[model samples]
Target: MKISDSFKSAIVEAICLLYILLFVYASVSKIIDFENFQVQLGQSPLLSAFAVPVSLGIPILELIIAFILLFPKFRYIGLMSSFGLMVMFTAYIFIMLYFSPFIPCSCGGILEKMSWNMHLVFNILLLMMAVCALLFFDKKSFFLRTKQFTVRLLLCTMISSVLIIILIFTFSEKIIHNENPFLRRYPPHPAEFSNAVRLKFNSYYLSGFADGRIYLGNYTTPAQIISFNSNLKDRKVHKIIFDPANTRFKVISWYVKGNYFYLLDGSIHKIFRGDIKTWKIDTELKDFPFFTRAIPIDSTTLVFRTNKGKKMTNTIGKFTNEQQVKVKYFEGLLQAQNEGVFDTDGVLMYSEELNKIVYLYYYRNGFVVADKNGKVENRGNTIDTIKHVNLKVSVLKNGTEYAISSPSITVNSSSTVYKNILFVRSQVKGRLENDQLWEKSFIIDVYDFRKNIYLYSFPIYHSSPAKKFSSFLATRTHIYALLGSDLVVYEIKNDLKKEMNSK
Candidate 1:
């Protein structure tokens, strides 16, 4: 038996009414909580770069479709638009479920309460209703054979909608990581706080990790070394047996690698090497080039950064102390934007497993990866957009002493490198991120050094309001951070662990 024309018309009208209610409710809810909707979009892996425009466009477009569905003359067009939109929504959910690095909640109204799988089913049902309504509605005036032409058009619309989403997904990831517009993609629980230990003073810095223990050096007492076990439960204090009989040591730092620890005083051009078991300075080296920073690659080789040439520009070099000291400089490793001294200043990290040294610029967005012998390998950028240093330098009355005249913007504050991953503490804030979260925690951005791409970012929350992370070190299993007078440890979650294990 064939259905009556009146019955088909009634069916189409009922479906259109359902669509009108859904769109109107969703659009209004999005408008009511507009900031939250935009933030959800900013965290989306597929739409982060286009968050601002898409957040505003989606709700307005929904309202327009709802208004069109109210009129009989335009009901066919509205149904077609609704069908296309539902197809797009279904495709988005599928991609978010399978392909996206992290899923973000962006649905409006009561639909926000639905799981992604449930939302997928809901969109599919709405899509089927749209198709049925289109077939039953009056489309005879628009085409010669209404049913056949409508089916073809619907197929084309579905393909076009899916393609658009795919294109957006492809380009948005590239733009979000490389040409970022200050939008941060924060996945859930990339790192978790495990335990913390408080020190007596705030003058401690993370020296290094060696033999499954975390070592910290005190700035006030340079000879003292505080060590903690992997769990941060067992603590031991060891002092370096050194005597500064006649040498004036203005600054001193400790570095532990493998089985030996080195006490370096760049101001006095001295380096003392001691065995970890005895903590005795058995060897002392003098008359070395002045260096502001140093990291040991092995027992005999050390990479150092120092000012070179007549302009006092910063340069990185490696020296080998076998029978004599042999130094090699990679002058092009650091690029200067303004004053080379401050502009080129950054954190230096070395991965013993990968044999790669990374120089992360404090005032810029990128870092340079080089080999152990000072060979430039790959230059990778962080997710931020700051490419140049925001610094102002002035010469004092003496004309010889220079000082930073203005508060400079720091991009990558502190960093550490494990086997294949580089973890950087970012200082700049991104779009749609909560200000309160920034005030309460420090943001850590992770990158894959092997692929030269950003992996993800997470927050290391502060224990108290007055305490902030001063320095941090990353091991294979955990991250050790120095927050004010406290030493904190965080366990790496599986989401970050997978990226770290990737090539």
Candidate 2:
């Protein structure tokens, strides 16, 4: 249908008036709630680096465009500017939906009530209006000389594309790294807790993993090793039989490797070796060094941590009966604070695949890696920022340790090493809202032991609000955690599993 020039002008005027009203309302609303607008922009995936300037400039530009559209003399230029701005907004929305790590909160005012999908539709409609206004205002600008308008639109799109690419390249690491603003990388229902069973005692802890089964050792019942299949089915308790008349020693520590288990009594300095298949002690070696913490490397060699008598200096060393290899390898590994005996205590883990020993401090945001001989290899930082043990300890006259102040734990609470990945349960919270998230769930920070870099973190929901996951064992497909007296198994998310396998 052929339309009159006067009717086309009227339609163009109405579109211009609508845009003016929209921009004016939006700009005024942003100015009234400027702080909130700026904060929301700071959380944006692409514009976080220039959040301050963008937050201040967007409203000003909107107001200027609205005023320009109100004047008939500059209406064409105003419509051109509106088309360009709407194109940029629409492109941003499209990229956010497709490429962004996560979507942030909405902009303030009326837009805040709309979802991102709805906002994208609204932007597209406004863009169509701008294009219609531009076409009606021009006669030769569209049909005869298609070259002019097409070139301008293409140029605007190219400019916006370049800007988005640069922002993504520059700020993606800021969003993915430990100091990230976005936290919802995985789904809320990513894992399902199953096969929860009550343990015989709260002191029954995960001793080792071997032969596709988990071994639970109790402190009270040291001779009993409870084994469960990977799926928490087929429970079997193996009782190690020893000759009673040979020697009497309390089992202070127990560990299991491929097909053998070791029981060490640090008080009597005796080591007992037994076959895991037969569950019988065959060899008893005496004159072993006293170690507070120990783990087996082979049937003949062991890695242990012992405290030196003077000044409570603790050191890590290896022990072998071949030539009495009781040499301290990690001397002065602990930084002495007020007291060094218990303040620098940490969990030790040995990875057979990497052949590296990892020492994760309970109070700090760092871990040390060394070879089997205790030679220092590399030291890496955890995601947290704490470096020192925040504790107050005093040594009494009788050489007993006393805590004057209860310390606040701010770093690695629990950690386990498997293959090339180190999974640490963090007590510290990263860049996330909801202060109660820490209380409601356990946050796991994953790191690459081979490359020494933090990969990612995920939340594991707790069955109860007050209960925290004390320890967890990671299998190929699931993670079994000892929560209070019950065991909760959670299947690892497929994406996380792929991430671990890829690295």
Top TM-score model: 1
Candidate 2 ranges with C-alpha deviation above 4 Å: 1-154, 174-194, 244-253, 264-268, 322-326, 332-338, 398-406
In order of appearance, the predictions have TM-scores of 0.94, 0.77
**Per-residue lDDT of 137 in model 1:** 79
**Tens-digit lDDT track for model 2 on 1-503?**
99887888988999999999999999999999887687666556666645667788889999999999988878877887887777777777877787765566788788889988999999989978877777677564334435366457647754775586556536754544534433323223334565777884678778777898888888888868898887787899999887746566665556778888888766667678888899898876656677777887888777878777566556777777665545455675555654776566788788776788888888877788888877777777786667777876666677744544666585778888777778888877654334566677887777776677666566777778756477887766677888777777777664557655563
Residue 38's lDDT within candidate 2 is: 76
Model 1 C-alpha lDDT per residue in residues 201-316, reported as the tens digit of each score: 99999888889999999989887898999879999999788776798887788999999999887777767788999988887766567898888888878888988886678899
State each model's CA lDDT, in order.
0.86, 0.73
The residue ranges of model 1 lying beyond 4 angstroms of the native Cα positions read 139-145, 396-400
Candidate 1: the clashing residue pairs are none
Q: What is the lDDT of residue 13 in candidate 1?
A: 88
RMSD of each: 2.0, 5.2
Per model, state how many residue pairs clash. 0, 0
